[model samples]
Target chain A: MQERVNPDKANLIAGATGDWEVVIGIEIHAQVTSKAKLFSGASTEFGGEPNSHVSLVDAAMPGMLPVINEECVAQAVRTGLGLKAKINLHSVFDRKNYFYPDLPQGYQISQYKHPIVGEGDVILDFKDGSTVTVGIERLHLEQDAGKSLHDQHPEHSFVDLNRSGVALMEIVSKPDLRSSEQAKAFISKLRTILRYLGTCDGNMEQGSMRADINVSVRKPRDDLGTRCEIKNMNSIRFIGQAIDYEARRQIDVIEDGGTIRQETRLFDTRTGETRAMRTKEEAHDYRYFPDPDLLPLEFTQDYVDALDADLPELPDAKKKRFVEDYELSAYDAGVLIASRAASDYFETVATGRDPKLASNWVTGDLFGALNKLGKEIGESPVSAESLGELVDLISDKTISGRIAKDVFDIMLETGEAPAKIVEKRGLKQVTDTGAIEKIVDEIIAANPDQVEQVKTKPKTLGWFVGQVMKATQGKANPQAVNDILREKLEVGEE
Target chain B: MKVDEATVRHIARLARIKVTDEEAKNLETELSAILTWVEQLGEVDTRNVAPLTSVVQMSMKKREDQVSDGDCADDIIANAPEVADHFFVVPKVVE
Candidate 1:
């Protein structure tokens, strides 16, 4: 693989006037995977009966004070550590004052100035063996608003407090991305890290994780342009489409001699366009202040150290180890370590076996079968031991690679061990050179015309080898058959 | 620290409160006086002192992440102005 190159050099959009560079920053709100709400003793289940998971604190009842959930705080710190960020020894929560139907307290409890996480970096890896380090501005802990169902009734919207007060870690990135491809890669790598840390599930479809993208376009080497924020993008595909559209829209506005307005816009997936939201007549003034009810969150360095010590090996490190230890290619290492379960499966299968062979089997054939069956690595029918055993049989010359493939298919269907399948079906390779030589002699005797042609054109010796394998029902040792044919036909003398 | 009529009207709208022009006019004088009174604290020469994080000096209390309280849908909606299917109903907000 080639050395990693700067992503900034590869991602400049050509416009009508000239090449315009898109500047992108993202704020990802990842719901913390905790059993209870952030400040309430309520179940943090995804889909429950309306208001079924709400506590008195979640509903903001009269004189109901919020009590911090320790697990949620630990989760945020773990996420910060997973991002290799600076964990603030002391952080404070503030009330972001706004009026919304989904917000029961008329304000969201968020972090304004002192977030729990400080500056970090996420390394975005591209398929071209190139990399970009996206700087994380900060990560803060916040409370999620509830759901508002407007179409439930004609006159009134129904509010479900089930999601209210749920803990969310807002991971904000600096404006380092220059294109939609970089943005997509940044989000994907961040999501993989969060999932590896077990801090967030990173399920976009479930609204557990979402993105607010800030997009702007400027001439190369020019000052930063005014940016508009796209709110609540849940899909990666739609995020790319929205950024492309929004950047082009901003470029067109500037080309028409109109300045771009900084506002929050929503992406219309159906239309593949972004339109400005019907903002309040006045610009948003969140009027943030420290929450009077909750005190400042403080922890010791030992706490952060303990959490960091317990973190699993993140994706980039694991991929590096795979490349170094297994001698797998960068792309193969990436595919094998995309998920924890798949990586674990590969490690187990490659423990004592040929690592390159195991990597090929796991990433190629096994992954293909899993995709066809709609199964994750955790639900694979073929155990790691069995797959490793199949590789071992190929390595030891107990079965040819072609017969091993058939054996692997049977192992997938029957969940049987590869060795047992080979034994039961008598599919072992004819490694007995005597038997293979006899079959090769018979095939050569019947094909003298093709043998004569092979002396002139040496590549036609494959025909004699193929005929020997066909005569032996593909169980002949292919190398032995080729060796015997070349000796019998004297094709190797030249 | 002057709170004008426009500022009063903006605050009123943000608080989701209805106000008459006369009320806003009165609030402009009252709110400006309150801000002027609160601004007197800025004149103190205690620049080196840290901001008071809490009135009580105790650390923030935390609870374990366990579902110890919930499943009270009926009690949660008992005080709502309108409730249906255990959900609080509000004026249609389409944005």
Candidate 2:
């Protein structure tokens, strides 16, 4: 990825004395791609009726044997391989004891001491050209708790078990993020990697993925200070804002002779501030123990190797290939490889076409239009072949670059092929020099009084050129008209 | 690691359960005795021993990624204490 254009004052938290460096680490809870719940044969689809997707096992019924879902484990391994992390052949699940109204079982089944995936690293490319590698401490499989809908009734709360027992992959990262921007970039890059690997959809809106940001500010070469965790931040924009708010809040507290307390806080999106949640001052003892209902999760080297063989091209590698093979700037490559579908769409459009032209249209006009319409590239009205053909028309001088924009708008509205639209509308450029010069001669003849002024007011010559283009219905070659007019008007000027 | 009356009372409050002072005092003695008895395992010098997380050794079992098991709300919520409109409702929580 190309470096950010304005990356000068990056990731720095300015304080009273000097710029204080903020240490950031994020824990992401990504829902595993599976058809059923982790322990029960229940649906994991979103927007289901409140209790429609629940099963007896999910409701903590007595004598319900918790059967593990195999696809969930495989998806975690695939994610681990995509991160280039170690896939532990042997892992364990333990019960995380807790109490909440939504938790029907009074405990969550999670991997405590022994996780499935270990020690992976992700290289995040900034918009300005710099890159940093954040370390993945581990990826553990856990079961999600049910939802408590407090808004359902005015006087009572309702419990929804649809999400309960769904599989979750909690990927923890090391404290390698230096600033809020870095934290956001790390998440975006990680989301791209996850989408490419087909493990988790990484949809933060539906709560398929959420982040817990641990932020602490310290002076240069100082020890780590008291850190606070902002929990369940879903939006990428909100993550950056929350980190900035928390970091500054900490610095202010310390400068005002108040000691920072380590606690869990929530980011209030409405007020754009961080508020501490009411909880015990001391951390709760999770009291994790091995779940006796299930056995140790073990796999073979062949299983890990097979999953590795099927791994897709991750974002970093794909971005590097786009830069090396297509000769595109890192910025363009980064934008193109933001999503798997976008990357595939770009490859098809860039093939056998002028790559730089293809890159500009795809990243600039195409993306801009989609952003306006609030649509994804996959849902675009203009297909890749149509856009590619439009680029080809400009490259081959069939239509000038300006005419291509008109044709593109028509294509978006009418879904017509670029060549067909150009043909029907007579938008093709007039490449014949003889035809262009004839119109140019006619313009100079009619405007004799203004022709003498062309020497002193060279800028007004554009009016004569525009008149010629208007006469030809905007099909005349712009360069041919300019050259013929410049040559003809130069006769008496010298 | 020693359990005392004050610690027992605090734990009960954290767990959101009601425990009387006499019960807490009696429970502390029993809990401390159990903890003291279990502390004998710590005396062993098993520095090289690997930590055991699971007693039964097996691989993870998986199912195909297909949404096949829903639409049984009546059966799933059969044991709820109170239900309204296919939902389990509790006394209103202010927080």
Best by TM-score: 1
> In model 1, what lDDT does residue A74 have?
99
lDDT of 2 by residue, B1-95 (tens): 58988788777775767888788888898889989999999999889997764564645455566665667899877878898888889877533
lDDT of 2 by residue, A369-394 (tens): 99999999999999998899999999
Please tell me which predicted candidate would have the highest DockQ against the true structure: 1
Write down the TM-score for model 1: 0.95
**After superposition, candidate 2 runs with Cα above 4 Å error:** A1-10, A281-283, A491-494, B10-17, B42-68, B93-95
Query: What is the DockQ score, from 0 to 1, of model 1?
Result: 0.86
Q: Provide the TM-score of chain B versus the true chain B for each model in turn.
A: 0.90, 0.82
Count clashing residue pairs per candidate.
0, 12
lDDT at residue A304 of model 1 (Cα atoms): 96
The CA lDDT at B56 in model 2 is: 49
